[model samples]
Target: MDERRESPGQADGAGRHREGEALPAPPRPPRGEELGGGGFAAEGQYFLKYDHSSYQQFRSWAPAVLFWAAVLCSIRFPAAAAAERSGEESAPPRVRVVIAPTLSYGPLWIALEEGFFRDEGLDVELLTMRRTAEALPSLAAGEVEVLGSHILPSHMNVIARGGRVRIVADKGHHDPDGCTSEAIVAAPSVIASGRLDDPARFEGLRVATDKGMSGYFYIDTLLATLGVSAEVLRTFDLPLSSKEAGFTNGAIDFSTAAEPWLTRLVRSGTAVKWKAVEDFVPGFQSGVILYGPALLDEDQGTGTRFLAGYLRGIRRYNEGKTDRNVEIIAEATELDPELVREACWISMRDDGEIDVESLVGYQRWALREGLIDRAVAPEEFWDPSFVRGANEILRSREAR
Candidate 1:
């Protein structure tokens, strides 16, 4: 028999250390020291002295006592360990997400419909808050846990003030080779009269825009590249639903449109896609994922799990706009199925990577445009580690 292997019964006086090595005797107390019946320490080891009768009783019963204790421990602890491993010990967390009514939220819908978030042990609730100004304060207050919305100067202002909301992942960006995801369209007359061809003729044109929003950032950036100052154009702060009407009545000569709205304007002959955003600002980081205080808590992994689920959804979205993708988008946005199918979908980074430099550049522009009091470093507003953790989680799942 191997000296290290002990019989489970231990009825033959086999109590020993786990390594099966005999313990060296502890150093003796000083000569004639009056050791009492109480436990005492000798050198670094503890000793429990017993009288002759106590020693006999202890020796006979110790083995059976330890044997039964081990059996009970084996039975009790594995059940608790297994419960923890299966995540049944704790209740699932509910994560509330805010999004706009647009195709950009397609990935979020995909994640929800596919049970990706649920797979991460999260229960997700989505709320729609289209306006950036309204959404920023709500996120800062932790009323919502996640936000998929525009990169706004107002949001930067909150971060500058020490807000805990974080920009975690990329939601949408202008793709150089993809369809018209974002572009500045013009009234048919504006394009027909050759105004679109002459950059200088952009002056004094009525533009449908909300100068308070980051739509100004994209417009200003593109106009700057063209040597046309945005100041020369008249601007209108109109809701997205009202922009089509503005174009229909010739109330707006220029405006920026995204996705199905872009396709709708062109289909109605209300506007012509005169300039693709990539021609001026390639890979513009127009949309981002934000996390509120609940998700940003350092001690919890909720943020990482939420993003991991979202990245899974993004991978599914990147598989091209198939019938399923169109169906999800049409139902989510309440757009016609044919229109959702016909519209050019915006491109997203499959790995949930955000263009940090583009975000930095946006803040500088915001500063110059007086939209924010100061420019913020990428670290102040962005948290890339969630994406890193999310990728690690996905990689581990794949490896498994």
Candidate 2:
């Protein structure tokens, strides 16, 4: 039989360290030889003999000591270790958004300015585009995650063609109270012609609007409501940037206007507000918050957080047309504060629920007019999960 020898640092069967293996370091002797009676001296100070056994013992246990040190560090600062493993701490993911510089985007502006997005662990960047048409390509390409604009026939047509886009939330709408941002404005010449109030006289008049835009549908609806055949009215295609000039030069008889343009037109004596669009179509959805595939499919969590922040901002906006909001709107639009204060505020739903009936009605009208190839079902066009989740989160916080 072979005999095994115990290691030097191993404890005995009685749980005692091996002989001379666990000796405590000798206490320091007094500084003087009379006090310590040391045999060696260095630089006029007596010195004790060097201990090789202690050095050997320290070397034997060094690995375990270092290992325990690391374990203790991890226990104390686990988050720091996890962060280092994942790389430098990162800021919240950014959600790029495109919006028109209109008062209808008040909620978006409020959300951005109030740091609501940040609070929800999202960074929002707002890109200003003059028209929704101008932003559609970017939205489709995933360059932008969200867009605030009127729900146009073009949007429906895109969906009908399998475009990965959908309306997620309400932006603005016309209300029964007749408080609307959009109005039908007539030029000074048309107003002076005494035909502004006469619906019958509206026939054959030149109405300017961007083709395939919500304004086009609005004009047709207005003409139909006035008992005038839309076929008889001359539809002039004009960009919004040029509409003011067109009205001033008397190049257009009528056009859809929104503040602060409406206020500017009336104040400039170039045009007069003939009627608010709400007077004809109450509870019409004039604008919506659209989401693209990137947000809905790839990063839905960020989208959900974004909606939570947006709903919070909407609540703040619905606090009524206060002076602070007017100032905020003025600063955002770069318009005069007084003009912003006097401009009509766009109506929005406080609960973030969209008017599904209004959206369906508009879609049917567009289909009938051949503006879209086919009607998109509500499920295919509207996604309520984000809003529902956001509301749940908000409600829980309120309860807390």
Candidate 3:
């Protein structure tokens, strides 16, 4: 019953505080510890009880977290960094090209065989179709990136309709020096009759052609150039494969033929080369390398690289139809090597130069023949920038 005990809640002067005004609760200890004191000696020093259970739990999971973090960093960072450093972490870009299964695509085959495309960071796949018309839809749809064939009347028709296909590079041309694949052939009966000796005798003769194709136009132009009225001759559309049979049966009197068919015809004594197309249409562009809109407009670099590699192959091809090249051509075309060696090789410009005037003239003729409804300007169909840029690159490499 002392005065200090009279009010139990009041301060007793023994480091005790009034009940309602309890000393501000000791500052809460930091995480993982509890606060305690050991009397007056330990007054200022907090006795923190270590949270060993919690520490043990954190320790148990730390290695796993660190391990996962390291794994994620490696997965995210090193591959990208290594790819940047090596410059070859990814495979080369692939270009899907379509071509007719004809010797006209010699440069493309040469490019594939000689690794020209590989040198340009491209993986080119050459798909062979029986005809260009079969590939045109794919070209328009971007399913096919390139087409190796002639600029046909049908192509002009497509251009007139605002189609997105374009002629980017020249594949083959009619050389004035008699280096040409196309020729006018007459059946042996016609040759034996000596009618081929006179150009006028070609009048009123039936000619076979792959209608809607450049060959049809070639025969038309050839006759006109030779002073024979194209109207006088009757044209029958026939596939090149069937021309041999037609000639054998005397159904084809006259036809524009390309090697190795021309060679095969002569060797088998079924027909004879009456005249080379180059004789009249000198420097005529018979075949071209076409590009779809996706390649020409959206992905121009690939188009440029393809042309560069194609030009390299063309330059190599122009090295004078060697035996090795004949073998290569034979292997690609599946024709006999002897026939390939004997057949006339189409002339392609070393620089992939296209005869723009010839192309325009062909289009004009197509318009006149009602093949195309309107004329499409050369600029609309020909984009020479890729070819020009490719040539510049080739020249720089040669200079280097």
TM-score for each prediction? Answer: 0.76, 0.76, 0.75
On lDDT, the candidate that comes out on top is 1
Q: lDDT tens digits, residues 175-250, model 2?
A: 9784668888888888888986787776778888765777777787887877876787788787565777898776
Model 1 clashing residue pairs (backbone): none
Q: Evaluate candidate 1 by giving its C-alpha RMSD to the native, one decimal.
A: 23.7
Per-residue lDDT of candidate 1, residues 307-391 (tens digit): 9999999999889778888887677667888888888778899889988888788777778778898998888888898999999
lDDT: worst 10-residue window of model 2: 1-10
Name the regions of candidate 3 deviating beyond 4 angstroms. Answer: 1-88, 196-204, 225-228
Worst 10 residues of 3 by lDDT: 1-10
Please say which candidate is ahead in TM-score: 2 or 3.
Answer: 2
lDDT of 3 by residue, 145-200 (tens): 88777777767767778788888888888889856688888887898898767777
Cα-based lDDT at residue 101, candidate 3? 50
Deviation from truth (RMSD, Å), model 2: 26.5
For residue 351, what is the lDDT in candidate 3?
79
